[model samples]
Each structure stands twice: as structure tokens, then as C-alpha cells.
Target: MKNALKEIILAAATAAHQKGIFPSSDFCEVVLEEPKADSHGDLSTNMAMQMAKTQRMSPRKIAETLIDHLDDTRGLIDRTEIAGPGFINFFIRPSAWYPVLAAIHEQDDQYGRCDLGKGTRIQIEFVSSNPTGPLHVGHGRGGAVGDSTANILSFCGFDVQKEYYINDSGRQIQTLGMSVYLRGKELLGETVDFPDTCYQGDYIRDLAGELLEREGRELFDKSEAETIMPCARYAAEKITEGMRADLVDFGVTFDQWFSEQSLYDSGKVAGDIRDFKEKGLIYEKDGALWFKTSDYGDEKDRVVVRQNGQTTYFASDITYHKDKFERGFQKVIDVWGADHHGYIPRMKAAVVASGYDRDQFNVLLVQLVNLLRAGQPVAMSTRAGEFVTLSDVVKEVGRDAARFIFLTRHYESSLDFDLELAKQKTNDNPVYYVQYVHARISSIHRKAGSDGLDVSGFAPSDLSALETREDIVLIKALARYPEAVETAGALREPHRITYYLMTLSAAFHTYYNRHRVLCEDDLKLTRARLYLISAVQKVIRNGLALLGVSAPDAM
Candidate 1:
């Protein structure tokens, strides 16, 4: 209907221009927006004002001329008005919205899916935590955002691959090895001083104990350097496996688990640096190789290789991202902790320095999660291994509640996850509030079916029975599901679907309370309402699926 309205107005403008009544047949962009207030109209556009300068006339006059030429052959627009500043407000016929319900029923799961990405290859790398310890709440939040983002993008017709880049190499792993090694020596009755640089976690001791039992005393008899790598590999492999298991339990499974060591091992890092040097993007200063990041919008130059000849962590990141583009992804999105917010510019610089478009690189900086019981904050520390793991949260609250809660807010904002509220079956709990609508609608269908009404087989002729105010509002909300998904995907904000679900759920609950779907008095109206709510059910299910949450038949 929005597209129809745009066509009608554009046709009118073209007619006006052909008759030489309006100058410049080429006009500015015609954007139709829904007015905030219902009285303003169903949709609004400012094409006349946009064309005022081109037509060399008053916006009001041009609006009037264009309005006069509108054909309305499709009979979609009820009326049109020239409002303040020459805004053309379109009042669409109420009957036009009824078709939305039919469309929803016909499309089903494919209703909200769109082609905004148009099959563009996109890679989303998220929650790439160091394989040194269990995943903390922050990683959980990132996992949710990244997984949902990939889901939404895939729904929007992007060739999406979800990946988790494993930081299995470098200094962190060495420290983890040392931490486990020192703990292993202590387990062997050797008096060794543990350095403060070592990881302080009970899991480290557990890894040491496991290594002692598995490899025995002979392995420990080797030189400390020899034992360090084995311990590091063992602990890293164990921790990474735990992370993968936890993420799967949390309702996120990646398409790939990329190893950071692969870049160095495959010589991609050195080959990439050589290419950069050939392109003159790499330079030397004080015996260190620096990338010309400042020239590509970074705050200053960044060292890819230190004076000691060891590549920095940033070097591997640059290679990884560049490798992402080389692997045929037109766009790369990285989900990182908000603490890495400052690193975005330099990363963007690296992307551009590597000959990729700046717009092709995007980052979602997810803020910390503040877990609470009731209203009080729960204490947590990642280094001390005292923080609540994602697995623990999922076990307590269930995966659906956790994913929905993690996605309740935009990724840039901090989330306050209340264990008590999530467990409650009340309307105050947002996930339950939304899920109940689906369950309630399912109950309605069951009731209608048992009551001898063919609710599932509802075939509509004229939906004039759905002419009530609440009916129109609900139908309009249903009509906007695709818009919500498109906006969420285009803007990279997964919370839009969450907000849409909440609103739709509220509207459905209000309507359900005020009216009866399986009314015995008016059979026609009952079937109409049944079909409408069925569309609602389908949409709710689709939205929850995008967020990786379940829309249960019984909550």
C-alpha cells in the first residue's frame, strides 16, 4: 500500500510535468513516512516541498497541483491533504489494511523476511574470547547480539556466515600455560613462586590437576619451557571446548570456529605485511614496522611489528579482517566488548589501508551485563573466575529467557539482567509477556477448533467484520513487521524486533481481554478475528525465531 501510494503520487507528478504545469520532470527522492498522530493520516510524504526549488513555485501550490493530478485508480488513498510546510499526508482506506492479515497468513514464516541485503556476502565475527577461561557474562551478551544479528541478516537475504575467532595464540595463552604450569608444580609438591601475571582462577588449578593425571610425572620432568606449550594447548583446548558447549547451550552455534594461530602458521600475516609494504602502506620508524593507519583516518600510526620483531596483536586482527574480505565477504561485522570501543577507528583504518571500503567494516560494541537478584547487584570478577558463567545463567533462567533478555536493549547500552524477574511468569517479565501472547493465541485456536469453528481453515471473502478501531490498529501493527525487521537489519540493531514484539504482544493482550475470538453469537466475526490472531501468532513466532527465542505453544 505504501508502494502504491508512492506510485500514485509519482504518476501525478509525472503527469503534471508532462503538461508543462510543473518544471523539472526529475524530482527529488519521494519518501513516504507514517505520521505519528492518527489524525495526520496513514502515511505522509514531502515530495512537493522537495520539488519546490526544482519547480520554481511555492511548495503549497506544487502540492495542490500534484494532488489534483493524482489518479487514485487503485482506490488506496481515502484522501490527501497539504499540511504545514507542504507535507502531503495520505489517508489510506481502512479496507486496505485488512489485506495485510491475509498476506501474513499466506507468507507465514516468510512474512517478515526481506531482501534488504540482496544476497551480499557478509561475515559476522563475534564473541571471539581468549581461550584461557570460561566465557563471562559480557561474552554471553556479545554472543546473543552476534547470533541474532546474523539471524536477522540472513532473514534479510544476506549470505551470512557466523564465526567465532579463537584467540588461541599469543601472550594470553602463554600466561594461561604458565598459570597452569605453576599450579601443576605445586600439585607435584614443588615450592614454586607463582607470578602475579598468572591467571587467578580455580579453573587453572583444575586444568593443572587434569594435566597431572593425564600426562603423569614424566611430562612434568621436561624443561619448564617444554611443559608450558603442552599445558597451554591442553588448557586452551579444554577452555575452548567449554566455551563452544556453553554457547551451544545458550542457543548460539557458529558456522565456523576460526583459529587465530592459523594466520601466523599459514604465513598469511607475513604475506599480508609484504603486500602492505608493496602498497607503501607499511613503513618503519625506530626499527619497528608501522602501518599508515593515520593516513586512513586513524588517530595516529599503529605498529604492526614491534622493534623486537614480534608482531602485535593488532597485526593478526588486520590480517584476519583482510582475510575475511578475501574470502568473498562484501561486509565484515565484528561484535566486541564495549571496552574495545576505542579500537574501532584504528581497525577501520586497517580495513581501508588493506584496500577495503571503510563502510564495509562495522563493529557492534556490546556493553557489560549487570546481573542482579531482585534489584541488588550480584558480585562478579572475570579474573578471579568468580563471575557467573553463561552456562550457569542459561541453566537457571533457560535459554529463551536469557537470549531475549540479552537482546532487550540495543547492544551499545548496558543491560541489567534480573534473575528474579526473568524467572517470574508475570507481565513484568518481557520475554514471558511476549511468549504468553503466542501461547494465548494457540489456546484461542484450540478453543475455536474444539468449539466446531474451522479457525485454521478460515477463508476470508470480505473482512469488513474487522472494522473496529482495535482491529485496525492490530492489523497496522501486523503490517509493519517487515518494516521492523528491515530496520533492525539495515541499522544493525536487533532490539527493534524485540520492541516490535513487545508492542504487538501488548496490543494483542489488550484486544484479547476486551474481546472474544471464538464468540458464539457472530460466527463470521469469530472467523475473522481468528484469522487475524493467527497472523499475529505467525508474526510473533517469526520475530522470536529471529532473536533465537522460542515462541512456545504453552509458556
Candidate 2:
């Protein structure tokens, strides 16, 4: 549909060129928009207004000329109107949209797919939660956003890589080890005080039990420095295992689990710092190695290495990004929590300093998620090991319900995920609303098959014969699916798919309530209606699949 729209605009431009008028190619970016109110038309574009300055004419005149020159595709486009301020609104015929049902039937699950990306290599790094504790609701939000985003990109024809950057070389892992060790000691009847910095989740006890089973009492009684590192290593591994299980249950997988420790082991961090020093981009100030990030529009010069000779998180990030680019990814998308919002500029500056185009990198700051139970906020305390873990949420609500609820809101907005609301089987839970449509469609197909009708190799012609208004609405919504997918994928906003699925399912349910697809007398119409409804069902299924949500044929 995007390509179709582009062809229409380009044809109009070519006509203006033939008329010895400066043909407007710049209208390419002129917002080709869908009318907010359905009464306006099927589709609208502001190409004329965008060309007004170049054409040396008012937008209305330019629209009139362009509309006159638009090529006719049979009767697909009934007419093109130049509305207020040169808005070109195209009124496409019913037959034009009717083909979309056939197209869906023909293409099946691959209807909305495109080759726009052309297999460009891309890497999306997201949800690299620390191994110190189990993933919370905040981490769940990141998981859904990152997984769905990568899924959307993959559907759009990119050779996409999903990555998780493990912060295994950090202080947090050590704190986790100490927490587990202390819990183990307490279990052994030793009065051990838990450190304030240690992870205080009940999962720590589980990790401790594993350590006890592995190393026994000898390692437990070892000296603090010797015991802490190995214990931390064990704890980190255990916690990361839990993270993996949780994500697997949530339906996300990573192509790579990049270790921060590798950067240090391979001397990439030192090499990057040395390279920056050679380029005069680094300087020693008050015993710290400072990178000239301020020169690249950052707020201030940032320390890559502190006065104590230890590299900061920023240094590790610099080498990691450098490694990402060197891996030959044409584009890199990093999904960071919103609290790390300030880190965006410095990372981009480092990429620029490393001599890479800034456009190649994108940082998406997922705002946050505040979990609620019934209608009140759920209090969480990591120290007491009493927080609502992501796994807990999954157990409370099934994976499909959990994922659909998490994705119901945009990633950039704070989410108020309510346990009770998400668990509902009604329309309040959009997962069910969308799935019900799929199941209903499936039921219709089953009925069609049982009635001895040959559904295979069936072709739908004369869609006008199916005259229910609900049928038209369903066809219209299905027709808009390709455009919806294009918009959602282009904008990297998966929430649009959620919204679209809801609207599509609503149309199906409304039609189901008002109209009947199965009848003994109107067998041909029933079959045609089933064909139409089943196509819509496939679209809904595909859309849910893109969001990593399930569309069950039953319940």
C-alpha cells in the first residue's frame, strides 16, 4: 500500500513534469495521511501543499492539475478530490478494497510482508537485565518492547539480530554473590548480616542452596575476598539462568549474549582509549582520562577511566558500541531504561568520535512500568526478596495475557499494568478480544468444512453480493492492514499493531453479533462470508504473531 501510494504520487509528479511545470518530487515526504474521520475518504495526501512553493502556484491549483493527471487503474480510484488547502483525498471504489480479501486469501500469513529492508544487517540490543536478581515488571516491559520490535523488523525483511549485552563484569554481580553467601551462612546457623547493597530477593536463597549443593561447607567458610568472587560468579550464573527461563517463557530469544568482560579481556577498552588519546580526543584531568564528549554536543566532558585507573561504565559502553559497528551491522538499536536517559548523548558522541555516522545508531528509552494489583500499586522490596517478579506476573496471568497487556501501552509512556484487569476474559483484556475473533473465524471454517464445502482453491468474486454493513467494515479493516503494518514498522512503534488488532477484532465481533455467517439456505453467501471472515482472522493472527502474542482458535 505504501508503494502503491508512492506510485500514485510519482505519477502525478511525472504529469506535472510533462506540462513544463517544475515537477514536485519533494512531495515524497509530504504526509500521505489517513483521514481521522472515515467520512473523508479511504486515503489522503498533502502532496500539493508540499509542492506549492516550487510550482509558484497556490496548493489548490496544483492539486487540481495533479488530480486531473492521476492515472486510472480501472475503477480502483473512483475519484480524486482537492479538498481544503490542497489536500488530495482519494475515494477508492469498493472493488478496489475488495481485492484485499482475495489478496489475504492468496498470500495468507504473508500478506503484509515487504522487502523494503532488502536483508540489511541490523542488530537490536535490549533487555540486558543485570544477573543480580530476577526480572521485575520493569524488565518485563523492556522484554516485550524489544522482542516485538525485533520481530517487527524481521517481518519487514531485515536480516535482524537480537542481542542482550550482559553486564557480568560489574559490581552488581559481586553483590549478588555476597547476598547468596550470607543467606547460606544464615541457613548454617551463623549470624551473618546482609549487606545493604546485596540483592534481597527470595531467589537469592535458591541460588545459595545451589551453591551449597555444589561446593559444600569448605567454600562457604573461605575468606571474604576469595569466597565473594566465586560465589558472585555462581550467583550471577544462577540468576542469569532464571532470566533465560523467564524470557523463554515470555517468548523471546537472543541471537547473542555479549559479555562486558570480553571487552576487557580482549583489550578493546584499552585500545579504544588509546586510539582516542592519539586523536587528541582524550585528556588527563585531575587524574581521570576524559573523553571530549562536550565537543560533540554533550553536556560535559565524560570520564572514560576514573582517577583510580578503573574504567567507568561509559568506557565499556564505548568499546561495546565500537564492537557493534565493526560487526558490520548497518543499523544498531539500543533499548535502554529511561533512567539512563542522560547516557544517550555521550554514547552517540562516542560513536561519532569513533568515526561512524550518528544515523547508524538509535537509542530507545523505554520509560517504565509501575505494577498494580486490583487498583492499588504493589509495593516491591528487593532487600526483603518480596517484589513481584516477572515470572510471578506470568504465573498470575498466562503468557499471552501478560504479553498483550504489557504491549497495550506505548513503550515511551509509563504503564500501569493491573493484575486483575489483565486476567479478565472480557473485552477489557484485548488479548482475548483479538483471540476471540480468530477462534470465531476458525469455528466458521470448521462449519464450512463439515458442510462438505470445498474451501480449498476457493476464489472470491463479486464481493458486492455480500451486502452486510458489518461485512464491509471487516473488509475495510482488512484492506487497511497492509498500511497499518507499514506505518507501525516504519515508525518502530509496535503499539500501533496492538491498537489495530483491537479495532479489527472489534469489527469482527460486532459483525458476528449482528450478522450470521452460517445458514442452511444461503450456502454460497455463507461460504463467501466465511472466506472473508477467515481472511480477516488470518490477518489478526499474523498481527498478533508479530507482537509475539498468541491467537488461540479456542478460548
Assess each prediction's global lDDT (C-alpha) against the native. 0.91, 0.83
lDDT of 2 by residue, 117-187 (tens): 78989999999987788888888888888889888888888889999998998667767768888988987
Instruction: Point out where model 2 deviates above 4 Å.
Output: 1-32, 37-39, 46-73, 79-82, 85-88, 451-457
Worst 10 residues of 1 by lDDT: 453-462
Against the true structure, what is each candidate's TM-score?
Answer: 0.96, 0.92
Worst 10 residues of 2 by lDDT: 454-463
lDDT of the structure predicted as candidate 2: 0.83
RMSD after CA superposition, every candidate = 1.7, 2.6
Q: How accurate is candidate 1 locally (lDDT)?
A: 0.91
